[model samples]
Target: MMLEYLPLAVVAIVGVPLALAALTRRGDRALTRLALALFDGWVADRGRRQRERRELLYEVHLEDTYRMYASKTLLYAGLVALAGSVVGVYLAAGVLALFKISPETVRATLPQQLWFLADLLVFPDLSLGELFTLLAFSSATLGVAGGAITYWIRWENLSYRANARARQIDESIARTVAFFYALSRSGMAFPEIMRSLARNRSVYGETAEEVAVAVKSMDYAGLDMLSAIERLADRTPSQKFREFTDNLASVLQSGQSIPAYLDDQYERYREDAEAEQEAFLELLATLAEAYVSVFVVAPLLFITILVIMGLMAIGRTLPLLRVIAYFAVPLANVGFIIYLDSITESLRATREAREIDAAPGLLAGVRRTDDPDADRTGTERPAVEGSAVRSDGGERPAADSSAGLAFERLAAFERVRWLRDLLSNPARTLRENPVYVLYATVPLGVLSVVLRAWPHLVAGTLTVETLDDFVVQAALVVVGSFAVVQELHRRRIDAIEAAVPDFLDRLASVNEAGMSIVESLERVADTELGALDAEVERLRTDMAWGVEARTALYRLEDRIDAPVITRVTTLLGNAMHASSDLARVLRIAADEAQDTRRLKRKRRQEMVTYVVIIYLAFVVFLVIIGSLNSILIPSLPTGAAAPDTGGAISGGPLAGISEVDVEAYTLLFFHTALVQALFSGLVAGQMGETSVKNGAKHAAVMLAIAYAVFLLLP
Candidate 1:
């Protein structure tokens, strides 16, 4: 009965739209205006509600909500909706036509085909008009659903953007508070400082935006700097920001020394930041280990078990196992990869948050004060006062401070320090520089290659066919030698850099004591008490062998490339040609070197999180690959194979290749090994704080592990 009336229904639906268009020809403008106003009010109300909730829940400031969609966005959205509706209608009509036309033929030739077509279209066996009616209903339903989903997502995105803006405002307030505190300490008037902040808002990032607002408030509303700051803080969503502003307000009201308070706060911020970084690093290390176990060890173990089981059950193997191993394995591995990436990104975000939270301290450290030298008075004063006496006397030498002490306290456990340094050396460099050890290992590589290929050679089958095996085996040995040599060189460089700083400081001190720079270098070289002493002695030898002092120092700089060494050398070389204040120059150089060292330490701390993440990612990659090979791939039917080549090679040396497509399998194994090596090396290089060459060792290790496992697998 419904089918008989479908044509009439379709006509009525088409007629109604035309009828409505005829009646509302001239009122579209008024209707559109009214609709837009309502929409605007609705959005504003929603925003207000959201702001209220955010304020209540997180102590956020409620900024005025503005309409997110501009006319352009609305126009684009309308265009997209219209296009989607047209596409949807066309598709529905096509599907309905297919269903209606194919029913008789499909039912006659293949009943299942009819059912499949019916399932897809949701209806079948209808006239053209009836099909049109069904198409109209289905297309409208789908188009509306899609449009609504898209709108909802866009709306949610707008809200998220608003929240982010609010957070940015809060961050700005916090930074401004810090800046004002710094300026106030430096004796800048409150109002003048606010103006300065306004002028340089761009430099402050998001914090500058709040400072701009404060400046505007003062200029336009007749509010003082303090009152404007209080208002800004009140409107900010950050609790830390609010607290900082409140403290600033109190300090301003009391007229206390802003500098002293800022200094104290800066130190506190540094300590807190350091603590957060330390925690993040600790978590990162744990994560790295977890990833290694899950990705590397677990996969290897599972693959090993699967291979063993498959080998043992060769005669009884089911076809389904191959399907599972190939298809299932790859898919599962892909899924695990996605999961690992998501986890890594999440952890990275958390780490970044921790870093950002520590920004106050970073800003404090950068803030310059007029009396910058005052903070260093305690340490610098003694050096300054004693300089003249030491310079004139040239007898009572500067005492070796505790800072000069090198390698005190040997381990009770019999020197594990060397072992630590060895492990800490970049692994990739060690692999790439295998030539350093090639002289020692060339014979061994030849032997391993010969021994491994002995069977084929002994059978008078030693031809080009077997050469690849020998070459591969020998290459591995060569690679191993390169790794060992690189390790040796890295250890030497680390020892030199570690000792260069204090050595330079001592040299500077000796130079300050009226000793010629050359004599100072000789004196430190003669001490023969530390790693730097040895390096200096090497320099002295070069000098004794007719090398100029400047040239020898330059050579040392080239070898070590330590920034401290470079700066000190540059200073000494310049002072040698100038009749300037050598003592002051040396002092300044030492201080700069110390600062560089401090910065380096901070950078290392920051990188620790990234290092851990890279390692974790590698581990996850390994686990996923392992799961694929061990479980998924083996389960697939396509992967299943017979043990023999149907007696084609029942009694030849080529039997192994015949029984399996050994060439293909070997190629696949090699490819996998190479990729694993490349990425593993990259991760190891990043983690080990060494060059990419250092990463080669990690790549080699992973490659070796992978190849061994694959070879051992049945």
Candidate 2:
């Protein structure tokens, strides 16, 4: 009867979290209401400091009251714990009995300090009453552990978010101050600047979020600007941000010139930003070294020592090595990567490519401004040469005679539009969306694995090694292909941004020299801007037809889609409206773009050392594991550690080993190296480019090396 319900218990244990995760992500308000209705009163009675700590959540814009959040946490965790207890009871009773592991064998294997795990591993023969007691004890223990862990993680995640947001603010506040300095010089009012910054939150990042908070208080809460600024100062985590707000409040109150104050603030923050970034780099360096020592070097040492010691003691230490290889090292590296990302996220340059819509007066502008012939022919006139539109805007005379045939041909051509696009440039789809590589590679990989496994299946010799090879090879193929596409896309975007500074400078110069927007674009397009030349020419073509200059800039930015170029175009588009000195605005935009490229180049140069460190650590790990597998394991006698009564070897490195599964040890070592390769590659990517997507190439390369090395080793 208990066994019958075990599957149900397992489902509840697994399904509850998945269902709750989906619900929480969707922000199901009904669930929130239900949780609050059930546990809100219980949560209200908690400690006072806990209630006070709710401010941290709101500061990071978590948007949940402590009452609702705590109630859900308690309610969800408690229910999950109930299911966990049931699962633990069944596992302790039915599952362990089914395994029927020998208690004597377990007792001899584990060391004295780890003897407790013997009971966990082996199901001892016991009286009915003692078994009941064990089941009951396991229920309570598992229940408590589950609830505590769930509740603690849920509560602590808010603090992590707050700290991460704070880091973002501190790192990017320099650019925010620069925007303020530029806008104030452009004669924008202080409040207008706040509103403008709030509108561009997508481009400006975390500082815009802080500014949005201030703007909300002023607009919706009826607070004065000084009061809002004071509140922001109190709430923000960055010392620089707080100081800037404090000074801003004083300037607003004293009626002092905002531009002059912002100028000083921008200059100070700009200089300080360099020092701050250097400090961040130092932090990354420390983390890289820590990762190598803890995750790479330490695991290697433990595995080596465990293999030797396990041989000496004649114990089954394979379980211990399995934990380090499969769970500890990989999970710790992923967590470290996430933590690094959280801290350094704001430092990474982020971009948004917004589509610029045509103006409401676009048609009116063409008729009134561009087309002097509009009064004569409001119908259609040639705006530019080679437009491909007929001069009279009428169909050809032959169209009337063979209209049906023409329509049939057009319909047939339209049906194959997708084919034309896909085949025109075969890699175009992959270029636009790198992940599409999976669509082609995943099926091919699966088929290849299936074919490789079929012969083994027929022969009934399909061992684990063959299956493992198939999976590893498939992963390399699929991921390697995707990495190639992602890398190509990344390089193309970088090339576009590299040329943006020069393009903007030339556009500004030509426009300031009394050329119209169209003339400036035409002239700029003639100059070589590397990958951006074609895009610039298209912009000229757009403006040459009656699209406004600002609109054309929008399209150019939308196509480029790089964060730096996005920011530059956004600044240019907005500044053009506010100031007549387009030249000055363009100069500032150019300077900002150039600064971003310089910073990125510097970051890559600095990060190369850490990337090298990670690879070196991985190589060291591989060489040691490989040498142990190929050299030491083969040389040792099978019963070397059994006893001095039968064995010639004694009191040396291979002393006192009983019967050991050398093949199992080799296989485990192979797996550990592969796991290390995958994570090491990801960390290297994160260190070098601040992105996991960028690390796939490194990961695939390292995995291939590990796979090839292991094949040669054993």
Tell me the lDDT of candidate 1.
0.51
**Residue by residue across 1-714, what tens digits does model 2's lDDT show?**
898887666756566655765568554576678789889888764577685467676667767777878888987788768877887787787775765777667677655556687768765578989988988889888888888899889878877777777777877887787777777676677787887777777777788899889999999999988898899888775666888899899899999998889878877877777788788788888888888899889989999998877766646688999998899988898898898777766755444422233322323222112332111112222222223445799643322324344444544765686578778976876786787788899999999999999999999999888888998999999989988998998999889888888988998898799776567778889999998988888887777667777667766765665778777766766665566556656666777778778777888899999899888988999999998888877776665334354334554445544466777988898889889999999989888887888899999999999999998875
**Per-model RMSD to reference:** 18.3, 8.5
Worst 10 residues of 1 by lDDT: 349-358
- Compared with the true structure, model 2 gives a TM-score of 0.76
Tell me model 2's lDDT, rounded to 2 decimals: 0.76
Worst 10 residues of 2 by lDDT: 373-382
Candidates' TM-scores? 0.41, 0.76
